[model samples]
Target chain A: MISLLQQEIESQPEVIARLLERETHHIQQIVAQLPPFDYALIAARGSSDHAATYAKYAWTTLAGYPVALAAPSLLTMYQARIRMAGALVIGISQSGQSPDIIAVLEEGKRQGRPTLAITNDGSSPLAAVADHVIELHAGPEKSVAATKTYTAQLAVMALFAAALSNDPRHMEETQQLPTALEATLRLSTPIMQAVERYRYMDRCITIGRGYNYATSFELALKLKELTYLMATAYSSADFRHGPIATIENGLPVFLVMPLGATFADMLTLAQDLRER
Target chain B: MISLLQQEIESQPEVIARLLERETHHIQQIVAQLPPFDYALIAARGSSDHAATYAKYAWTTLAGYPVALAAPSLLTMYQARIRMAGALVIGISQSGQSPDIIAVLEEGKRQGRPTLAITNDGSSPLAAVADHVIELHAGPEKSVAATKTYTAQLAVMALFAAALSNDPRHMEETQQLPTALEATLRLSTPIMQAVERYRYMDRCITIGRGYNYATSFELALKLKELTYLMATAYSSADFRHGPIATIENGLPVFLVMPLGATFADMLTLAQDLRER
Candidate 1:
């Protein structure tokens, strides 16, 4: 019998495939309806914040829109006034239950900024406040670890970037992502076996940057949440600076080696870590 | 013998005082000579990235200028074009040796944006490329863990915010921080006594947000750097969503409960952690 988490982790390919194919019109509409703003401000918490960070990289490099991750406590805790005019405010949450995120959306809407939400539940509070909502279309994820919904959120945001840029290549790659995910899932058996040695592994670090830096964060969170591993994440470049001092002999390190312009540098980091 | 790190931590007051008193002219010159931009883009790594996060909170709430933390690899790794015009780019570094940060400053300069660097080494690479440089007056910190420099960087950024907004209240607070830090350092005797139970502590989380979120990050980093503690940092609001699930009895939770708008929430979070 597989855990609910394992089941959901395996379901990502199907969920992402569905998200790209069925729910893109909503994102397209969001892209069309949003105000022409100089930048974007995103509000989220937990895994959703990691997803939002991914969008920060994508929106800058792909769409030429500078994206800033909002520290919602500025609104909720400090009670500061935010200038939302000529900016798009996006709230990313799976349940849409995070009050801080909802506050940002509501505030953005009140300030006449175009507000958008990417949430699993369109009926959730975030949706109620947002001017446009792009449902994650990831159905009822039951795992305490967000295996399916995390990937689905990534796909949805990737598609969102694609829509905003009118870039067909991104759309084509996103459409093919489900297949890539499926092929990748084939290693689960070996990965399960590999974890047997690390049952007592107490310390680790995850390194990534560029487009997949958010993946490093989410993966680190999942590892900590589900396995109780004392894992930390750093950008590959950052790892070189000083945190590398924390690495000891036999310390486990995880690298998200996504192929792209960052691949060569990540490979260097991987080699450096191996040398340690 | 007390390590250099401990000495540096104790020297924070003097370093910050020197910074505010002596570096005011350079900052004022920067304020007077810079092109007016819509917002700020900050680039940093490791502990400096944590400092950049503090600037994000301050620039948004205090100065009414939204700041985006630059993902440097977007240009260095992905070879992507960045929109830098009409923005102020700041690179924060202790040594000013991070190539990734230098890349951001160089690109911002090429794009004709005003670049300012805050660093301990006025002669380091970051200074050569910047349109303006504010030296951290924290002299000769030899420890692997930064102490005086981090606090100095924080003070400098606070002063920058004060100057940007021309807020006399913030300026007053900035001026008083050194004395406040000196007074706070007086508690080291009790603090050292308090850590007896946690001398063997292996796991912890540092919670803070708003003005002190960067303090949370810095504290967590220092714990990892010096003590090998598996310390993590989170905004109090984000902690409640999931990572709180990781808390067990006897886990060390350090809260940076500054007396500001975030005090009530930090108190609530401290209570919740105690209950757990």
Candidate 2:
């Protein structure tokens, strides 16, 4: 099954390539249409939401755009006072049909804010309402669980961030996504092997910081949805205050690392866990 | 802060009563309009997503609708073929702006499926595309860490299932939700006090069954998100497989019991853990 999925993923390089090109083009268009906005309100759910979160960080850090992640319920129920006049609402979803997302986007439209949809479904309702639509060509995935589509969404969002910021640096990094995804797939074997070892674990804790925070979140979800494992995800930094009390010998801990300044600190924490 | 939250929640009975009437009316109307379909698909993220997972069980058992929980990535990236042409797509969100939920709703619209959005923001993008919107009247929850909205969503979904299946059994039971919530809130002091007692532990495991399965899952999420704790949630039945190997002295195990059938089983498991 893993090999089949890997094969399926490999066959979609062109789709990934096309999706990258499309997002790149759409990013340029969004940059050209740069609405006078103070911040970007990004709305997304599940893995797509995680990708949007990554976009939030990238947009804030790279593009100097203030971004806030909104819960779909807040936009739908509260009619909260959003300073919408100068805000760009970016709705990210693969299907572009979730009722809450559509409602939020429609509300954004009603409020006269420009809305964009990053999706794979061109004819999706979100696309219909979006001022601009960036289509992802991930093709069909049969598993009830998500895999390739998540990587694809991340890739597109990375490109979107690059285009929005008009930062060549982000663009360069965005271009490396497909290759990164390919390399990441190699890690899947190790991850799967590791998961199998702890498949029957009463509980598992996944920890990461910064961009990888959502990575841990998504990983925990995958374990629950697929293997029915009991797992939780958390920011490594937050673990010290009170949560560390939950950790004990023999409990499985998975830490996601990105090469950065925080790596040293995370390593130290991991070492501490090992010694404990 | 927790006490303040409890006070606020206790004061909301009148508000919850009003909201319950409105939600029940909306749920009835939507369920009447639902086309014949094989199963239901719930798409959501974060706390709302956790509520939806609980709803999945309610829909399956109460409404007799085989329900599938969808991550937005599947709809957008993996292209998982949603099984029913007339399937009900229920999108749950507090803000109603999650991008992926919108994408899924967009896809459902393209496929001509009925879409329902349960959200707090009626004017948000998610409500805009929804055929029916059940607005949660949980007021403006200001905490970045969700508490009221989560419970409110669960309450609404429970009522929704009761309405959909025309089973007033749970509806009558649900009327006690606010009271139950208050009682749960009262237990908070004791629970936290208990937690404080074991705060020195490095990790803990929470287990439950049936609908409480998701309860365990959400508990883990809350523990991690709020306290940054390394907590894991597991099914009571699945606990003994291999995860029990890690169970030993000093490791805290929290078990949630359902109302009846599974309650005894959970008690047995707790006893076993105590003995271990």
Give the least accurate 10-residue stretch of model 2 chain B, judged by summed lDDT: B75-84
Candidate 2 per-residue lDDT over residues A1-276, each given as its tens digit: 456556666645556777777667667777788676655667777777778666645554455444545454343333333334445778888788877777767877988888988787889999999888877777776656566677777777667667766558777776766676667667866876766766557667788765676788788777666555557677675565346766767888888977864577679889989988
Model 1 pairs whose backbones collide: none
Q: What are the per-residue Cα lDDT tens digits for candidate 1 across A1-276?
A: 988888888888888878877787767776877767777889877888888899888878787777878887777766666666557888999999988889888888888888988899999988998888888778898877787888888887788778877787876777789899999999888988987988888768888888878888888888778776667788877667666776778888888887778888889888887888
lDDT of 1 by residue, B8-101 (tens): 8888888888998888767867887888786788988777787888888887788777778888777677666666655788999899988888
RMSD of 2: 14.3
Give me the runs in candidate 1 sitting further than 4 Å from their true place.
A1-3, B1-3, B25-29, B32-34, B123-125
Candidate 2 chain A: 10-residue stretch with minimal lDDT: A73-82
Tens digits of per-residue lDDT, candidate 2, B1-276, equal 456555545656645666777777667677777776545667787667778777756665566444445545444333444433435777888898888888777767877878888888999999998888888887777655566677778878788778766767777887776676666656766776776787666467889766776788778777766665667777675465445656667778888985654677788888888888
Question: DockQ for model 1?
Answer: 0.54
